[model samples]
Target: GVGAGGDMPNWMTFLISDVPLYLIAMPVAVVLMGKSTVIETRKFNMKPGMFFKLLLMCLPMMWVGSMVGSMLSLALSDGEATNRVADLAMQTNIWNVVFLVILGPIFEEWMFRKQLIDHTRKYGEKTAILLSGLAFGLFHMNLFQFFYAFLLGVMFGYIYMRTSKLRYSTAMHMIINFNGGVLAPWILTRVDLDQLDKVSQAAENGNVAAMEQWASQNATGLAIMLVYFLLYGAVILAGFVLLIRNFRKAEFYIAPEELPRGVRAKTVYGNVGMVTFIVLTVLLTAISLFL
Candidate 1:
């Protein structure tokens, strides 16, 4: 039903469909789960340096997850897979930026990190984080997003656990969304990709004159794209180094009601509801990839 507003602007569609679901349905679901499941707001006090460090460490993970998801989708669909989210990002406007970079993160962090983690952390911090990651991944219901979303969800969940504050995770979410939904798209819009492709084709065919003509006209755009790629590559490399250096420092606390290691899998996934949710999401992801 969320997709039913296809004729409307992206922001309007999201407001009419997703806002109600997040603002109303999510809270109602939490109420139905019982008051004990509610998460109380905590002070937002994470340092800027710490946030940057966390974000840097997460970059490589996000890159890897995205690569894996793309590879799997291409393999499954014989290289014909399409990413709707990416398509929407490419079409982003100011209103879309508001929803994608701000409102989306606020509601999503509230639902996935704050609410879900609070409800499940009683089982164990690790368990809660894993569940939150998996659920967040599946919530996308598309193969293109599941892996990167899952990895980011786990990272955000860890941040929430350490600070017991929504602001840190929410801010992190906002930054990532802004990069993907706003900054990256804006950079891409400056480049004439169709002309670039033609230039490439001309070069491959030994038509140097044609390539030079296109380059002369679009040199600035090419320079901008090249700089973006270089900067992005540097960040990704730094992220990998940070991830490796800090991997061993990661810690998980045992909850007071921690389930036994032997039964933890059963405790988390043996339920009918979770199994059904997983099955449905997997089916949807498969459909999105192949059909």
Candidate 2:
């Protein structure tokens, strides 16, 4: 039925599937989890600047994970995964932006960050963060996204722990999503592809003057593109430096009920329910590659 539905417009399909999952299914799941357990849902409250700081701190891990995922996707599937992502990006309209930018971050943080952290945090902060990150990655059920999602999950989880406010993480998530899903594609659409091709051809022929002229004619667009890439690159670079410099000074938390490290992780994740989710996600990820 899902495969058959692929024949429909991407917007329609997204509305039918992603919309309900975000708007309806996720909140119900969260509520059910809260009722089923004694654990209270995680909440957070922090100034907006803190999220930017978190983004900077997490950028290195996020960059490495995304790079690894991309290379693996290329090597294993010959970039089929990336092509599918690009196709989806090209299909984005207002509806897609709403889901991707607003609803998605809110619901996803509620599930992967809030729910997981709130439940297992009594065990240990480190364990809870790690497990939530793992669950977040696996929940994506796609190789191209799993790694970075996990990294971001850890960052978001930590923020939630600190502030106990969901709004901070939600805002951060929305910022990242908007940059990728809205700004990047919108900028790409504004670019003069024909001019870019000419510039490429000019460079290949060793005509620096022609290349300069082409750039001059499209100065405004080229400047916008340059600023975007530079700002993006600088954040990742700063993150790499900070991550390495502070690697050894990382914090750890002791669980109220201390267990062996392995036992602690097992207690958190090695349950029938979690194991079933892990299995299903792995199966779905494998199926996605072929599809």
Candidate 3:
């Protein structure tokens, strides 16, 4: 469904599948793992003002990742069509900006990062990382998204694991998604939306003379734009590093007793899960393409 169902997949169907399931299942997920997700931070604990220090430690890494990830998403994610979709989505009569930014983060963090993090512990962090990422990405229910989202999930999972603090991951996730995921493409799609199909078609039809001229005039411009984005991303990185340096400090984790034990050590995955995800992803891709 590259451009089917009016340029965005039928999110309504996912709303059906995901919203109810998550609402019902998330509470269950939380209840199941709530007690165990909490860990003993005593070993990691620090003096007062430690949270700020942790944030400081996290800031640069978050910012660096943000810049690089944003650059990748912008440079590579979609062509001009994505911008148009953003415009269309934004133009919705009830496009409440605050909800678009906040609701997604809160729910996703709770379900994907918090709950998933707590539950998959016994399988080992590596398994948890893959499962959590796969779960987070696949939960979105569409193809235009699954790959990047899964990658983002993995990254967020790492943040929680390495830092073992919910706030840092929460904050970073919100900013990244709000800016890069939700907003950047929103703006980009509207202004830069373009189609090169006519030119490509002409070229294919032996209009090489015109095609060569178009490439000569436009390719250099495109190359220049790419260079500008790269430099800008670097500057963003520098600022991020400065913030990190100023903010570095030791931190602690929450005690394990605060969290309840998850369902069973028996994961729904091991080898079976990977194969299942691949199959489902392929099937979804086919459905998206044909349906």
What ranking emerges by lDDT with the best candidate at the front?
A: 1, 2, 3
Give me the displacement of residue 152 in model 1, in angstroms. 0.7
Q: Write the per-residue lDDT of candidate 2 for residues 121-237, one digit (tens) a residue.
A: 777788888888888888766777779889988888877777767788788888887877788877766667767788788889998888788768777887888898899899989
Evaluate residue 194 in candidate 3 and report its C-alpha lDDT on the 0 to 100 scale: 48
Give model 1's TM-score versus the native structure. 0.90
Q: Which of 2 and 3 is ahead in TM-score?
A: 2
What C-alpha lDDT, on a 0 to 100 scale, does residue 213 get in candidate 2? 82
The TM-score, computed over Cα atoms with residue i paired to residue i, of candidate 3 is: 0.52
Give Cα distance to truth, residue 203, candidate 2, Å: 7.7
Which parts of model 3 are misplaced by more than 4 Å?
A: 1-18, 31-96, 189-286
Best by lDDT: 1
TM-score on alpha carbons, each prediction = 0.90, 0.82, 0.52
lDDT of each: 0.81, 0.73, 0.53
Candidate 1 lDDT tens digits, 192-258: 7778788899899999998888878878877888898899899989989988888888888778688
